[model samples]
Target: MKATVERATLMKSLGHVQSVVERRNTIPILSNVLIETSENGEIKLTATDLDLQIVESFAANNVETAGSITVPAHTLFDIVRKLPDGSEVQLNAADGRMAVNAGRARFSLQTLPRDDFPKIAEGDLPTSFEMPSSTLMEIIEKTRFAISSDETRYYLNGIFMHVSDDAEPTLKAAATDGHRLARYTLARPAGAEGMPDVIIPKKCVTEIHKLLGEAGDNMVRVDLSASKIRFTFAASVLTSKLIDGTFPDYNRVIPTGNDKLLTINPKAFFQGVDRVATIATERTRAVKMALEQDKITLSVTSPENGTAAEEVSGTYSNDEFEIGFNANYLKDILNEIESDTVELHLADASAPTLIREHDKSPSLYVLMPMRV
Candidate 1:
């Protein structure tokens, strides 16, 4: 293929596609990116690792000849990233190598037959809908932090997306790692009825977030089948295979009927937790929270390290309660909450604590207490 494209545009597209391609692959072609030129003077870039695939198309200048080839993803991306941002990049294929020239620099990269690249079959996606990019971003940011990194419970390694009937048919995203659970709900989009529950893998969630993040004021088209899901945004399309196992029923884990409520300044609580956590044990990293009439004290005591206690004034009129939780988990929830105040409902030290934003938010966090 022979084409002239802007260096910045080419680098940006390569950065997205190469991230999906694995550094080491048993199949050589999987490590390369497929570049093809169309009759309409548009260039298509594609990369895949069998389970996930990304395809993007962009308009390029002057196509001398129509052809297709595969080049090493890392090498090509490195070459483009080092070149001047707005310089005109020219690429031509000769024999089994691809030549790239921009400004005064020239490089030749080995190419593979584009036919060897795997293509994810486009099936008839019966369930298709569109959602505002911002809505999807909110769900991802709120729940992705709680996704389990434990490979054994592969089902919990991704976010669970389903339709909920609580009040209305709201779209719910939940993630859990046995210790903490995060759930967020959004108003269901029009024509999103009959969508099945799907567990999108963690990698797919991250990739889709990057793809839709810059899509300002645009809606993303989502298509889901039995085993795969596809996201189409702007000029790119990403398809990923869904996790096979079933996600645990997260509703049972969320605690209800927690009576004691403590409202605290979100910023102060987060900073207190951050400071006291320094003295916590390396393994548990537990921070104790003691709640009294209108005062809350955060303390962390370690056998090796000294104890630390910080008092934060709060709005509480309930009975005295004390609880211990992982400092990291508490910080994660606070970071996701976009409100000035945070409400923590407690039943007892042993039971799960429910956390909510002071404002109206269709989301809640459940954190399992630890033995201090």
Candidate 2:
């Protein structure tokens, strides 16, 4: 393929597509990006890692002839990025090698056959809908921290997205690591009817976040099939294979009748945990929470490192209660809360605790207490 493209445009598109290509590959073609020029002179770039795939299209200035070729993703990206921002770049494939030229610099890269690149099949997507980019971002940011890193329970390695009706036809996203669970809901998209529950893999969640962050538009189109899901933005499409196992029913883990309520300044609580956790050991980073009539104290002690304690002013009228939780879990929930204060509902030390922002919204967080 031969084409002349703007340096800045090519660099930006390559930066996005190249991230999908793995630095080390079992298959040589997987390390290269497929570049094809259309009749109208637009350039299309595609990259895949067998599990995730991305295709991006952009306008190019001139086309010598319509052709396709595969070239090393990282090499092409570096060559374009080093060129002057507005300089015009020319790329041509001849005699099994690709050549890139801009101004006074030129580089030749080994090329792979485009036919060797794997293609992700576009399955029959039964449910298709459009959701605001901001809404999708909120769902991911709130629940992604709780996704399990444990590969044993492979089902819990990704965010569980499904339709719910406790209040309305809401889009609920839930994640759990057996110790903590985070669940958040957003208003269902306008035409998102009859959507099935799907577990989007953790890698897909992260890639979608990057794509949405760069997308300046308002909404994104989502298409879901039985085994795969595709997210389409203005000029890019991300296709990912869904996890195969069944996700655990998360509702049972959420405590239903937690009576004790403690309202505390989120900033104060987070700061206290941060300070007390300093004394905690690397292996056991546990912080103890002692709640009384109108005061709360956070303490952490390690056999080798001694103890650290901090008192944070809070509004608590319930009976005396003490619980221990992983300091990292507390920090994750507090970081996601936007309100000034957070409400903690507890039943006992052994039961799960419920957390929510000051506003009476549908979102809630449940954390399993750790043994102190």
Specify the highest-TM-score model's number. Answer: 1
Residue-wise C-alpha lDDT for candidate 1, range 1-372, written one tens digit per residue = 799999988998998899999899999999999999877899999999988999988988878888999999999999999998689999999799999999999999999998888998867777888988988888899999999999999999999998877777888899999999999988887766888889999999999888876778788999997688999999889999989889999899788798899998888899989999987878759999999999999999888888999999899999887889999999999888777788998899999999989536877899999988
lDDT of 2 by residue, 45-115 (tens): 99999999999999999998789999999888988888987899999899999889999988999998887
Shift in Å, residue 280, candidate 2? 1.6
Clashing pairs in 2: none
Worst 10 residues of 2 by lDDT: 357-366
TM-score for each of the candidates: 0.98, 0.97
What TM-score does prediction 1 earn? 0.98
The Cα local distance difference test for each model comes to 0.90, 0.90
Candidate 2 off by > 4 Å = none
Give candidate 1's error at residue 251 in angstroms.
0.5
